[model samples]
Target: MSSRPEAAELGFGDIEVGQVYEIERSFSATDVQAFAAVSGDHSPLHVDPAYAAGTEFGSCVVHGILLASLFSQLVGMRVPGRHALYLGQDLTFRRPVLVGESVRAIAKVTAKSEATSTVVLNTEIRSSDDKVIVMGTAKVKVRDQVRESVAAASAASAVPAGAARSVALVTGASRGMGAEIARTLARRGHAVAVNYLRSADKAEQVVQEIVAAGGVAMAFQADVRDAEAVRAMTQQIVERLGPPTVLVNSAVGEFANRPIAELRWSDFEDHLEYQLKAVLNTCQSVHPLMKAAGAGAIVNMLSQVVGGVPPNGLADYVSAKTALLGLSKAMAAEWAEDGVRVNMVSPGLTRTEMTQHYHERVFKMEAARTPLKRIATTADVANSVSYLAGDDSAFMTGVNVFVTGGQTMI
Candidate 1:
């Protein structure tokens, strides 16, 4: 560790918009070797001087990713400090960085979201000669250390015995966006029911993680497409956690993007079962409980594809998701008098286990199309869900919030 003070030591509460931080370091040949050894990226441009000498740079150059890694150090150690999660980043390489060149990395807070405890920073790296090597923007989630402590103390003093917080049921929460939403709710003092279909072990793991973090969570298994199963699951949650006042319909089935010409009718049915039918089952099952409570929030997960379906395929998936948008609006209108608010969150090409196989291609395509120049992450979608599930959006209903990095503006 360099003699630099950590971000936590500097205190995040003292940070402000436009505040800047800088760190200077030089990447040595030894550092390059170590990076190569650890990352398995021993390319001729980085390691073979003989080959590198014939290239345009005329010398070995440090890996671009290696240079970008400096931004991580700047954010975690200098700016937001200890409790920071690097959510997303957009980088542009201005010039090649050669080993042993002293470089300065700078981060400036451009925007801050107090509701989410996240900050967006402008980032740049320059050589000692003042030549910019890399430039980009980064979004990081930081913990409000001081505020959290005060809130925790206040909550401890305010609540009465056996007075449980609101309950949130997140479906398909064994992993990906669902799991993160469950955890986020728990962190906000809500009792979370982690719903899963076949991933019992993974669901249990999510519960364990929440419990370890001092949050209340329990895993429940059910095939969301099955109405009977969903009803049983809701009953179990009611008995254990309490009636769920906030329900997030996030469970989805596998999508096969076959051309419309070759797609069979069953393909459409399959998606409907998972998307439309599942939402119907979950909503109907929880309607009574929420209606009786006099107030509740329901968040349904839709895909950005509904905005404009990709031509490559997924007609079945797109059709079903389009229907979900209408369903959300109808529910909002019908449930308004029942004191239940319904909303939708649509994400575009988010990084999740279901999309891992095509992660690289999808990321490149979506990032190029997105104005933010980055794909959405699980945390990004989770943050939107949290917003709609909480009192911040109490007056909002029948709205479709797109967490698509501006890919789907409508």
Candidate 2:
């Protein structure tokens, strides 16, 4: 078995359609004989070599049931995991499997029944050559259990909070994913400095919420586009939160869906100022503090469109993000020796207030196209940032983590 740890037991609430899990196994002739002895299917085609040699198969074949058994492992050991109980399964054998042939069994969730607490999975068994060996469907009901999404996500990467110096600075944290990143870092025991441009009230609200949750936080207002203002804000954060060892660059300009013909150079310039320039200012402001600490993390928020196909009207947004992405990689390369790691989180079409301009059909189309059958959530992006901002990713630098729910696989 792979050394990867098991996932948390999933309840109906935690399961999403189009989610997938798989396992592999190679059947041995000894295993076939054992099944033959147990099930009493001693047919020559399956057990007798000479009797089968004259037949179309030319050799003994493993029982279809032995291959289908992997689906049970898929349901019982993964996805919904230990909490799942089989409701039913329908199978269609597509090809024969000879002994010692390796096959991978895959299960993908197709539907969820809220009323019945059941999940339907499209199941398949494929040969090592990528040929479909068997195809089937399974219906499983998950046992009720509490969902611990945050805990499970952090289990792999989180360090002991009290033992680590965790001070976080999240820019544009007055609302949206930024606010959530601030809150999440605080929850992970970081003293959060919430940076905002104009929404002091919203920034203060985020700070108060963190305080109420038994976490340390403070709000700082600064125009990240101004290098001097960013440096000043860093001084304030240092005085209060002990200098930010974790910096999240999320201060971005307002997006507009305008075509090239309808746009001005200022439009693209505005995005570059908000994205590339603001990030540069913040990174410089926090670099000295992080270098002094001997270890630091920078989580740059970027968009998936920069790496994939861009929509017609989003050239400005895409261009800005592209520049930011390149800058982040360069920083990661140059700053590694200084103990400051730079990484990026690029999320797909997330349903946030900024994206309210997207039409319902467009939203649905994106979700349907995604492998997970849904758009990225703020929590999804926030969790990725948290992982990159922590000790779990200590050895990682210059990597881009995609929070796109498999929309843009790169």
Candidate 3:
């Protein structure tokens, strides 16, 4: 028997229900075309826009099977791997996935038959718009009695209020992925300080919901760009929720979708203050507390736009986020010896209040531009952030994980 973690060791009986599997994969134009060629699924629906234009779907629809294949990509190498056997799958297509759309596949364990060495999982395929193009269920087999037992026990001893949940400070928790991240951290037994700058009402609502759900959370107001305010907020949070070991910098100033020619220097400075400076302030303020603890995870919200394919009017936003990547790497290098891990999550176009405007004007056009034809959702990005904040990414640092739906391949 190996002394390594269940995830690292290979065995059969270790499979357990209630575990979740997720991965963000980009499908390139070549990928779609390749899969089409190999699978002989060259329906005009998948290959030819002109042929699909007259159909009910109105355009070239991505092959459903291609999106579903992402489920295999998520688990095949990361989970049970070669030892696991795919027993069955059931898919329900909700919307047409168009070519070039980047898709994210998610699977959650719904049932288990340890005796039979089988685990059943519910699966989902979501477009960037946060719409479910397809959903289904899958079953796999694994072996490992002791690992399974531990999994079961952890599930049974669910984290309760006042219990041994970790503490996480989440900035920009008033809406979108920040709010979802706060809720998820609470659910996973983390006492959460839901931080918001201007949205006190939304922050309060998140706190209420956490408490209502039998978790511990408090709303704190602090503008991350203000160093003094951030320091003060850290003190208050420590007083309220213990010293936070997890920090998620999710605060981003709104970007005016105007051309650079139409923007002023102040607009550029404002974006830098909110996006880049805010990250710096939080990381600097939290360093002492985290170093004393000898363990911490800090995640900063970045944008995939920084990778490539600049949008119409987001130069300031893009510039600041690009700098954030460098900040993340520099912090990781400086703090790794202290056992602090820093990482960046550059989420693709997500469906949020800020994006509803884009959704109205260019959602379809944007969808057509990517391999997985859609935008990401708050939950999509939130789930990934939680994993990075959790113990799962204990070895991960200085990496910019793009949650874009196959938008920028390189």
Could you tally the backbone clashes for each prediction? 0, 0, 22
* Steric clash pairs (candidate 2): none
Instruction: List model 2 lDDT by residue over 61-142, tens digit each.
Output: 8898978889988898886887888877767798899877889999987555332355667789999989998986676777
Off by over 4 Å in 2: 1-165
Taking all chains together, the TM-score of candidate 2 against the true structure is 0.60
Which of 1 and 3 is ahead in lDDT? 1
Q: What lDDT does each candidate get?
A: 0.83, 0.83, 0.77
How would you encode candidate 1's per-residue C-alpha lDDT over 1-410 as one tens digit per residue?
A: 69865465444455666689999988888889889999999998998889999999888899999999899998878777777878777778999988888899999875543324556677999999898889877877677678556545554553333434688999999988899999888887787899999899999999999878878888999999999898778867765566688999999888876889999999999989978899999998787667645679999999887786455688888889888999999999999987899999998888788888884776898799889999898888888999999999999999999888887765
Q: Candidate 3's C-alpha lDDT?
A: 0.77
lDDT of 2 at 295: 75
Task: Write candidate 3's Cα lDDT for 185-245 as tens digits.
Answer: 8878888899998889999999899888988888899988899899788767754455678
Candidate 1 Cα misplacement greater than 4 A, ranges: 1-164
The weakest ten consecutive residues by lDDT in model 2 span 155-164
What's model 1's TM-score? 0.60
Q: Cα RMSD to native, each candidate?
A: 20.6, 19.4, 20.7
RMSD of 1: 20.6
